[model samples]
Target chain A: MIALSINWHAEDQAWLLVAQNRRGLPFGIGGSQLVAGGALLALSAPMAGRVASWAAVNPHDPTPLLRPPAWDDAVVAAAILGAALLLALLSRWTERLGLRTMLEMRSEEGREPLVGPVSVTLGPDRATIRGATWEASYDAALLTGIEEPPGYLILRFGAARPVMLPRRDLTEPDAAAVRDWAAGVLGHDDAAP
Target chain B: MNEVSSGTPPRRPWERPVTPPSARPAGLWTSPAPDRGPVLVVRVDTEDEVAASRLAVAAMTPRGGLGSAALGGLVMLTAVTAVLASGSGWKSPVPEGLPLLAILAAIAAFAGLGWLAGAYLLPLVRRWASVAHARRVLRPGPDGVPPDGGGPARVVLGTRALHWTGPRAARRFDVALLRGLVEDRDHMMLRFGLVSVVVLPRRDLAPEQQEAVRDWVRRHAREGRA
Candidate 1:
């Protein structure tokens, strides 16, 4: 068994990304923006056309177009667009906040580290993770895939919470060995000969 | 050792269990029941249908009931505003010299009201639809079978999978693929993957059977966590 210690940080963006992906954000950031922008344009196009028509009819009298009421449509459109943008940002912030709160509660205010400074023992076909209050053994054959994202290794099992192992705690050779072992267990072509 | 020498071929990992006719659970006829363990049969009714529809919608929209309603209201408001603007000969609806803040506030208030109204009303509409669907599908005949000849609607729970036989179709949900199991006051929702759910009403189940179902869910959930 290859045993390694992990200094887990719950505040990591990698974890956030994993959490967000698992929960699944409908429309996502760019998609939401696109939908909001498209709706704004669609809602405002009629108003724009109407203004153009008014201008065409009363070309001489620019006074009506300059009135405050004339800009009501624009104001409403801008407000809606603003609300949409604000909502997008708020949703992202809320998710992160909620994740932090959940972690805090689970870890009991840092008295117990849910994933912090945990010891992991990698067997030929399974990995045993020991936390402060809990220990879980995961079968490597059941793992869907292994994600190597920058300085972390994420073990993904279908419908189960992924296990994140930071590479900083392990020696380079050890990290490589773990990755190759996982790859081999998962039947990936990149596994070492 | 020769190519011709063969007993029954070894079962593949993904092959479904071939339950014998004698061991098949009662009230299930569409296919062979999973022979993993004891089977629990739960009958379907209008309430179960309604709950299923509600749960399905909830699963589809992860933002919860209020958020989904609010979003719907916003979209509807935008469409309505556009239509009215076009109909009113392009004239501004606001009075002259109206403050931008006031206009924004009024719009926000309208959206909020719409959201509340939708949140209240959408469930009623869903319930009505579900009731109608149940009437059509689960309408019992004099012989206790469906008039449409599709047979009785029921869900058979096994250790390895869930078999749901509706009025017109049957679905098999493998236990390994189930994402979560949620039990509320009236229904037990078996969530498969993300959006698929099987709602089993507890009204027809005996207390001991209900406990058995709970125990099964608990055991599987723990295994899944492990």
Candidate 2:
């Protein structure tokens, strides 16, 4: 299992914590910390022997931002690319550290109160949110498939996505505990899945 | 509130006096008054949204920041790449000025495209932000249900923070840069990719759930402010 984290803060800033794994495949996650409404909406890794082929016609152009701002449009431009490459590098670094690639890795552990499956359980005294199946614990389970339903939370993305939980019955505190704990674990933003 | 001759009068209790659009504020800005009239409310925890939608995400990925900067950088990168690929010392047939200039022009176009992409996709992000906020201030309102519509079998992964509900007024959300999307009783139609969102009423949610719902509405308005 690989252990790494990425943080996408507001004001257009991002950070990555990359550490190599044993499978010769890197492992890591990336998203936003700030600007709660907008986070990493997409992520992908080519199948076996597909990267080189994809790179052949790779449409990505790493041109530099030449705009000269009074303060730092250029600085921001550089940071933009810097963040992208950093995310990419961190992924590779995780591989070098022997961690499996996110596409290949699965989570099996995380904080407690999380039993298994997906659903939002609310009963007499509890609130709990359950995560999905993965070989790695919370440390390596890069959350994917994030959505917004202008219906919950404080961010302005309008959405009404249903909750995910495993327990058929739950306590009131379990529901509240899950809600509070999940927010704390996932942070205020939708960076992690 | 004056009743519109036609549609259902969905006005909230606090929105007796409506504010004119002209009196609104300017740029990346939120209205001084959080309470325009009444607020839209909802309450769902891990129970309503079955784990069906849950997925893993990194703690803090710079996707939003990247989207913001993409306009500035993507253009330049594509242009430079085109110029280099045109190779000054190659048996290439493409001309120098035309190809280089074309690349520059393409850069400009790509930049615009990036901005457009960011604008259109924000609402989807905003929708999730509500759930994120709900997770933070998790509390069953009156009943032990998730929220009203959420029943008792939903799942919640996290939250951003719930905002207090504003009075009757025009709450907004930025669909894109400088773009304002109002979600009041008048225009409650939710248009998503080719589908419409069926939003429920606030009464359905528990008290705590109601707060979460109000926060979601306020946040939706705030997204536009950004």
Candidate 3:
């Protein structure tokens, strides 16, 4: 099992996570923007579709007799494409807005941290986040289907937003513990850290 | 350890007393017992649903709040467009006066409206309705059993199966086959095949009752809890 401790690096404006699992994969995360950007990128396709459909059904002139069907289809296609681009832009803007909201919520005159250090303890089929206002214990089974990207570990607990942990933040011991923990959840017989 | 904080506090009156074989009481807690055996029942009432629903929605979305944020932005844009279209002559910028922009704006406006309704309005109404139903169901009526309508909507965790009963529908699944458990501060979700049951933390219960349920869930719901 890997053992690690993490501290909020205020000067760098990032979380300084140290793990001890040399065999664990290295990824980068810790900032809210990283997760927010990734999530928005994932939803871009569906958002585009929705935007396009909306543009098609909404007519500036309520009287449909004013426009030809062929012209409407073309307009709709353009609208869909345009909506997607606009939404992509809007997603970034909102992400910034959300980050700002989170920071403001935590800052004391933009100085004191609202969220304290978070301690994670991983055991057999269980993981617990302690010393945070939103402290919780989860059944690690919920993460069975999570796909680990090359460097990132996505820890999802049902109904809560998944927390993306960058493997880069972990040390060899931490990585080993994580790999062992993930192996159990993922049901793999041969995962070495 | 500090002497002030070292020892446990005295137990409260409402709390179930711990006893040996000679001091055991006939009924320590009065919660309904599942067929398998007596387990702490977390009876979910109507209050605190908006917050709970938010947790459920967060789980269903791919990236957590991205979906909601996008929808919210779209709603704001459409609302502005709707207002502009109504006042000034808002026309489509596209060729042939297809009214493309107006149509798009209208669509955005309506979709945004619908999202808001589903996210907020519908849940509020359901919460109100459930509270109303529970009132009548728990009322001192002729029969002690719940009114002819199904029992107050609850997620019952039995030793073998997990059951959910609403006013009109009921569902149960073997606990052993449950796929996963996801929980945040506001809600706990149990997933089966494709469906999920969202169980909210009961705030209305006495402190002891709530603790009992939490202890029970920590043991039964989480894997490898002995």
Candidate 4:
């Protein structure tokens, strides 16, 4: 388990979720996405340069493009375009899957990324989050695994990704108790991994 | 005088004229401070000292909501243009520009942009002007006197003493006396006791100058509470 920094803020959980959600979106889907798209487009720049050179040499030939090894050029152009589209779609799909997994795990763990203070209650087979703005409960049996990463407590509930909770809000004594509690509850289930 | 009287008078129009040495102004005082550093050093004549200091403090006056106001105006302009472009049979605001009124709408949108620029950007320019004015007023000319000489006083800020030199002068105010720093409209007030000095824009100050002020006030603020 990584020791949490004293300067950390509890509300950082909201920002972490936001960052995670942003990460789930593929490159070229929002701001700064254009850089990746532009790089992909540049891959075809050499072919474009060749086309420009060919057109300049055959200025009088209106059908210069048609005069080329037509089938090969068409196939190459189509393949490049197809590759670009396929990559973009794949990126978008993976991001969405990651976002879904995070959200699902968050729901199962009965935690939410919000600004207000949060309190928790854990029993033999259930967990509850009492937030200033919201309250939620979850079946503790759904907790599949727990990862005690540095500065964070991540709980996995049958999702590809886990729900992260920053440990900044917890005092040293409280952190130790929570750590012990998690170790006991997840001890049997986490044994598989 | 002899050349003029002896008819060796002014040469050809192409020739330059010799002028007498200009007499320097009296009672002018220039501070012994260095102005080439990161610190904002202003040398004001004793007479203009207070007003000039006020103007300097005014420079720190924060202009609030300028960004939001500009953005809102831009969004409104875009919405108006989009509406005008659609030609959705909406009545023309400036009826004579045409039945379509697109050109008139564009003109009106541009006018709104102009207004936004004037309202938000002009104050920023004015704040810089105040800083420049203070700097010029404070910088002593070759004669060991401020160019805009009026008094014998000098105030050197962002310096070792944060010194003010003159009669009845509070020569130095320890950073510990820095009670608070705040902005009021177009002027920033640096409070000490119940008094505050207006100063220039924070952006106009060199990074070191800004940091010096920040460190001074912040350290003092923490100490004062203790």
User: Best candidate per lDDT, number?
Assistant: 1
Fnat (0 to 1) per candidate: 0.00, 0.01, 0.07, 0.00
Candidate 1 residue pairs in backbone clash = none
Candidate with maximal TM-score: 1
Residue range with the least summed lDDT across 10 consecutive positions in model 1 chain B: B141-150
Positional deviation of B196 in candidate 2, in angstroms?
Answer: 27
Writing each residue's lDDT as its tens digit, candidate 2 over A19-112 gives 1011122222222222222222111111101221222222242222222233343444455555665665554443333322221121222211
lDDT of each: 0.51, 0.29, 0.42, 0.41
In candidate 4, what are the lDDT values of residues A1-193, reduced to their tens digit?
2222222133344344334323433332321222333333333333332333323233333453344444654665566566666665555455445444544444343332333345555555545443432333344444555666577766653231234566765677766765676677767756765
- Candidate 4: deviation at residue B178, Å? 47
Write the residue-wise lDDT of candidate 3 on A101-136 in tens digits: 544443433222323354666656445544322223
Predicted structure 4: lDDT: 0.41
Expressed as tens digits, the lDDT of each residue in B41-95 for candidate 2 is 4333433332112111211122343464464345456435543565521223434
What are the per-residue Cα lDDT tens digits for candidate 1 across A1-193? Answer: 6788887665553354434332434433333433444454446434443444333233334553354444766666676666666665565556566556655553444333343677777777666665543344445554556777787777754322356777777789888888877777767534635
TM-score of each: 0.43, 0.26, 0.35, 0.29
lDDT of 3 by residue, B1-226 (tens): 3533767575433334222223212221112324342223344433333334344334433432335545555644553455455553333453564445545554555456545644564344434433343343234323232221223544445555554444322334545434445555545555432223445454434556455445545555424311
Candidate 2 lDDT: 0.29
B42-94: candidate 1 lDDT, tens digit per residue: 56544465566456544433332465445544554554455446664224553
Off by over 4 Å in 4: A1-11, A18-40, A51-58, A62-113, A160-163, A190-193, B1-226
**Model 4 misses residue A191 by how many Å?**
6.5
lDDT of 1 at B89: 28
Native contacts recovered by model 1: 0.00
Q: Distance (Å) between predicted and true CA of B40, model 2? A: 12
Judging by DockQ, tell me the better candidate of 1 and 2.
2
